[model samples]
Target chain A: MARLFKPRMLALAVLAALASRAHAEPAAAPARAEVLHWWTSGGESAAARTLADAFRAAGGTWIDTAVAGSEQARAVAVSRVAGGNPPTAALFNASRQFRDLVDQGQLTALDDVARQGGWDRVMPPAILDAVRVNGHVYAAPVDIHMTAWIWYSKAAFKKAGIAAEPRSVEELFQALDRLRAAGLIPLAHGGQPWQDSIVFRAVLASVGGRDLYLRVFRDRDPRAIESPEFRQVLLTFRRLHGYVDAGSPGRHWNDATGLLVAGRAGVQIMGDWVRAEFSAARQRAGVDYGCLPGLGEHAPYVIQADAFVFPKNRDAATARTQALLATTVTSPAVQVSFSSRKGSLPVRSDVELPSPDPCVALAAALMRDRARQLPNDEMFLTPDQAGAMADVLTAYWNRDMPVETVQKKVVAALRDDL
Target chain B: MRATWAARAALVPVALTALLGYLGSTLWTAQMSVTASRTLPSDHFVGMAQYVRLFSNERWLLSLDNLLLYGVLFISACLLAGSVLAILVDREIAARGWLRQIFLYPYAMSFIATGAVWQWILNPTDGIQAVGRALGFSAFRFDWIVDPDRVLLTIVIATAWQASGFVMAILLAGLSGVDPDLWRAARIDGIPTWRVYTSIVLPQLGYAFATALVLLLTGVVKLYDAVVAMTQGGPGTASEVPTKFIMDHLYGRANLGLASAGAIVLLVTVLALLAPFLYARTRAAASIA
Candidate 1:
């Protein structure tokens, strides 16, 4: 009891000292931005560090609070704002996340920065629309990620007697069968909800075509969901489930990529971030692994962007920090450098990528075609609806649930979202 | 008066802490639950709408069901295993101190590391399956973590392994405080060992059992880290718990309205389960007085 009591007393004393000393760092005159973000992974950390380094170099002190996952970092930021201790700026995805923040008057408007930078001319309209809440910019776009990309192991393909990339879904499945016949796991799936949705969206685009994809996810049309086109998409999504191994359930996304890296798996339907894992393994791109934008020639390229939002702060010093952050995150040189390490395309349309990763170049080329651009579910639907739809999709994929039943649940979830 | 002043000063910190940390957060969460908050809290009031959604969510409902199953199994297993281990250790066994340390060591390590180790150990391809095949047990299968129906059981097993030691330590302390004279008298009366234990010794452990139960119950209510680190509430959310459900919406889903409702529901559930027992204890105490 004495030992426990003594430690508790010490802890209390230390906490009391810290509590009194909170936010009393001799308020610097220049903008001192405290940024909370989820870029703690090696590549992501490097990307964030470059941004911070630039911010510091440009007459500011960059205080970085690094958390691991996007979900966790966002939660901390939101809670901090509620608790009346909001950070200067925090990283957020380019989705509907900032809508609620803006509704609560928690985020500061960045219209001044947008005008100063002439963001209207450079940033894509879709990208601009995602950040703008009621005709005002709430976030600064950092990087863009293309979600519907298929990564394959060259060694696994060679072993399976696949000479080149498959242009269509039929040939893709045929290649998967050949890989499985060669005694390799065909689809390296993580089995998490997000990864499951990614593969489903891939199939929806490649098999069901672009209009049907948009109608089901974006429009949430009941007829579209019940149509034969959507049913084929669901069937194709479920068909890929057969190629995945039993151990794929509840597996981490990185571990699934590990199978590909080890040549134990043939293909992974993942985002551009898989390139980071391949690079980390010291494997040269195009030699060790190959990336396909979509299964077919004219498939829509699904895209998601990561961005940062500045929460509204009354303090002048904190406001200055927010303005600096908005300016620093969107600078062209910073965008290209940060996106290069992150395996994502820069949000700015004009910036040229330096990395010669054939996969990234193909994605860049596809991204240039405005007609091929597709929004992820989050870009169109509320986070709640997307999550609910993901739950239904995962349940359908995991079990032998009837497609008709899934369609009903999808409609029900969308109705609930309203 | 001076002593009283010192006592009041000592309690000032605790009172302030309880008010600011516990009560304040509770009120804040309760207030937020009634509002139409989403990714962030809004001032607009939308009474019970979030609760309606919470109840409608299949994952939240499944998590609530899993929590009940996990709570029952985990608390019972820990209590039984702890009591048995305490009794065994209390005997004139060789190297008793070493054995006690071995049993209690798991409690010293964080559950994050332990959960990962257990996940690897229970994984089919890399763990027991490989070893089983290596040992010529070709037909052996120990992949409970991947089996949807059996995944919760795996969580229970892993959690019980890490927690039973703490229970053993508590029960051992209680067992040591038992009157040695009672045991000597029982032996002289020629009473059977099993009977002596069940009738006399077990009854003396009621207070210790209560303490262990409360500790384990608290653990059951907040069982997020182990489940996350091990299964991530998956194999299709089979091992999902209410705390994980609340946390997922609180952050990942960015649906605080639903998260707040889940938190309130969880709190009410814990209070409802604990109230009757607490009331009974108070009544018993009053009657004895």
Candidate 2:
């Protein structure tokens, strides 16, 4: 009886020690941060690690609560704030996504950090407009992504006997025709609505030029939407549908990128994030693939960005950590490293990038020219209006809806907008 | 008299839960439906404009139609399959425990994983269609998962696979309670086993079937996971359902007003449909007593 009791007492003592050690350090806990973001993929995780490393180096304890999808991440953040257990900072798109949170006084402003970082002068106008609400900056811009970049396979182009990149919409179509004639799928497109809209925007800007694109989306001008020029752009977008493969519907964007990686497809109109896919397959930019920003003159470069907004917290440690995170994220050195891993351009134009990334170099050069800078659909339209318009466009793309009907539908969708 | 006090004490929890959890949420949802709430709840009332928008939206209309189709097919298939499996188990088959576990495997899986597996199996290029073609049947086509007209049927198949197992388990519980004397009496009357099951057994299991049907109906109403995992309400909103529409509006679309309106509509429709059935249940029990 004595022998058995002694061993049980020993086990109980071990458990007590473990429990006490776990509970001993609550008062001494460092500037603790619980960041919530949707960066679960391998490359995305690597990019996030850059930020985590920066935060840790600044004497903050990093706690990552990475959710996989953007909507799920935002939902978790919303529930946390509403339940009075908010995270230190939450990732939001550099759009009006967090406008509701700001309006409800659920987000902490970063005016001090923004002023110190000189964000107004360094950040581009479209990005500045996204992060600033009223008079104060509410979020820190991390990286800038250009949607609707034309990515093409160099091997596929060579096989199709095309010598150079297409300079105009007509040339691009002719190149697609050549790829088709060479017995290849000319467009490696995923049939989801967002991807569909990306392809449509690419055509809208590159084909119809910048002003026409803005009038339809930014101004929500009904007359421009129903105009002959916009109709022509719509028809051009329809023509690309013929070049896509039959099994394109319900395919993931990565699988569509796989087609280009394998050189079985010619062109994929996608965001700069596809560069990560190319890199994953060990494909170089200029040698293995090529990126076209837009059709030469009068082209508009649409920008999208990712940022982190702090949940409203008066805790001294949380405030300190949030300020540190803002500085780390916006710093030129960290932005360069994070953006490189993220497969996008740095938000600051002054950030030095390696020359190997020809695509980002081109985007940065276009970024310097304010005339070519355009906001993506998310930057201008609210998420609801954007989703509604995307539904109509996706339906029109998949179904046999007439262009005139689509024009009318766009008008109806924007009828209630401010 | 003391036992009466104890019984009354037990009613307090039920009463509070019904008032605060159920009734409170329903009222909140109804209020929000009238207001132009976006992302967060607001007091800016816009009357029935949200409902007006909901009715006019083509996507919402498609969602309702899809839900109706999916509900009918999923319920019928699950009941038919469950009844058949329950009968097989009731016959005292060999290795009954193993068979029961195997049949219940899909019910234990999360719908997200099962939906993904079904998506892979039904995907035209890499799934069964490709395998069939590779085996020299070049004309094979199993593209219903992508086709707008037939996508909902594929959802029915995937959901039925997950739900029928659960129905079978419930019916088996009911089957176990059948008095063995009834079988002996039927045998003495020279009644066939199948006829005995159809006539004597099925009628007794009515309550179990009703329970399973109610559970399955709730699942059909909140059919977000299977649709999102399998097709994401694509290709071009082909397989959209009411819950998915509400979720998209609530989160991705940031239109809480429209989503709340949709939720209220769904809840009212379900309650209205269940009212008669519930009334009949209570009346039948009263008559029996």
Q: Which candidate is the best by TM-score?
A: 1
Model 1, B1-289: lDDT tens digits are: 9999999999998999999998898888888888877777666798888888788888888988999999999998898888788887878468778878999998889777898899899988888987998899999999888888899888889889888888999988898899989989999999997788778997899988888988899899988888877877777667878887777676667777778888989999889878877998999999999
Candidate 2 lDDT, tens digit per residue, A214-233? 89888999999999999998
For model 1, the superposed segments whose C-alpha errors exceed 4 Å read: A1-27, A115-118, A315-325, A416-418, B1-9, B185-192
lDDT of 1 by residue, A181-256 (tens): 9999999998887888999888888888888888987798999998877888898899889899878887777788
Model 2 complex DockQ against the native: 0.41
* Fnat (0 to 1) per candidate: 0.54, 0.53
Candidate 1: lDDT over CA atoms? 0.82
Candidate 2 regions exceeding 4 Å error are A1-33, A56-61, A316-321, B1-15, B88-92, B172-208
Number of the predicted model whose lDDT against the real structure is largest: 2
Which 10 consecutive positions of candidate 1 chain B have the poorest summed lDDT? B244-253
Model no. 1, DockQ: 0.45
Model 2 C-alpha lDDT per residue in residues B1-289, reported as the tens digit of each score: 9999999999999999999999998999999999999977889989999999999998999999989988999999999999998898768678778778988999998877788789889988788998999999999998888788888899999899888888999999999999999999999999999999899999899989999998888888988888877888887878888987887787777788999999999999899878878999999999999
Candidate 2 displacement at residue B101 in angstroms? 2.9
Please give the TM-score of chain B in predicted model 1. 0.95
Q: Cα lDDT of model 2 overall?
A: 0.84
Question: How large is the interface RMSD of each prediction?
Answer: 6.0, 10.6
